[model samples]
Target chain A: MTQKYYAQIYVTLRPSVLDPAGVAVRSGVQQMGYDNVEQVRIGKYIEVTLNANSEDEAKTQLDRICDLLLANPVIETYRFDLTTVSSEVQTS
Target chain B: MTQKYYAQIYVTLRPSVLDPAGVAVRSGVQQMGYDNVEQVRIGKYIEVTLNANSEDEAKTQLDRICDLLLANPVIETYRFDLTTVSSEVQTS
Candidate 1:
């Protein structure tokens, strides 16, 4: 009876890190007709699906992942949310 | 009159790119007591607030930013959503 879980993680550069992508996007928005646009920043989203028994356990593991690999504390920051889907549930 | 705009960008590694962070997060989830957990992948998020007159124009600039800096099409991918806030609006 394995339970399914989904986690969404967002990662971004620290304000100190130069975000060329953000700058570029800002420029693009202006060109695309957003005359009022002034600044732009860029980041990432990671979605993970897995099986877990409990939310507490899943969260504990997620934190470790963030610290060890999902984010580089030196220059990037990360945040995440978790959701659970029971194996017994049906999707139509 | 100047308009305020908010843009959220999500960036991720192409499936071809080896995601060490994802792997690490997966491992962390397991350690955190998520016995049934299976897989994890990591990515980024960027938020930008600026001034824009029209959605079309803003979109254009956003696209340029993505191509020029926000996303590295070679190994990373990006997407964005835009919202407008009138300068006349007050936040208390």
Candidate 2:
């Protein structure tokens, strides 16, 4: 049976890098009626669902993937979380 | 009074767009012991905190910003959410 795993990865730039996208979002939020908003930062969120034998193995594989391809070690940093669901779980 | 807003924007490639990153992540998860993993998709997550006068205004501004700069409408699509907190709320 195939077990399902959900992973969320967040990627962001180091503080030193310029964040034009973040600034634009900040300004947009302010215009949207949140005048109190002060600062804004932007990043990437990646979600994946995969089949795994066990939670531990899935995490280990995901780590390697992040290091090798998903994340660019030279410029961006990333953090991820993995969750497992039994194949028996109902999917609507 | 300044209001605080937290916005989360998720950006992803259209289904037609090839997702090499997503494929890499899926393979990585499988390698880690998640043999059951089947498919994976990758996208961007953007978080921003900004100051605005009212909730409505902030949302409008944020929309403009997203259209003008934060998102690349040509290739990527994005969705966002906004939350407001009173300035009096404690920040640790």
- List, residue by residue over B1-92, the lDDT tens digit for candidate 1: 45677888777888889999878767776776655556677666778787655778767766776677667889988878888866568767
- Model 1, residue B55: C-alpha shift (Å): 1.0
- Which portions of model 2 miss their true places by more than 4 Å? A16-40, A72-75, A83-92, B20-37, B72-75, B85-92
Q: In angstroms, how far off is B79's CA in candidate 2?
A: 2.3
| Global lDDT of model 1 | 0.74
Q: Give the DockQ-based CAPRI class for model 1.
A: acceptable
TM per candidate comes to: 0.63, 0.64
- The ten-residue window of minimal lDDT in model 2 chain A covers A28-37
What are the per-model DockQ values?
A: 0.48, 0.46
Candidate number of the best DockQ: 1
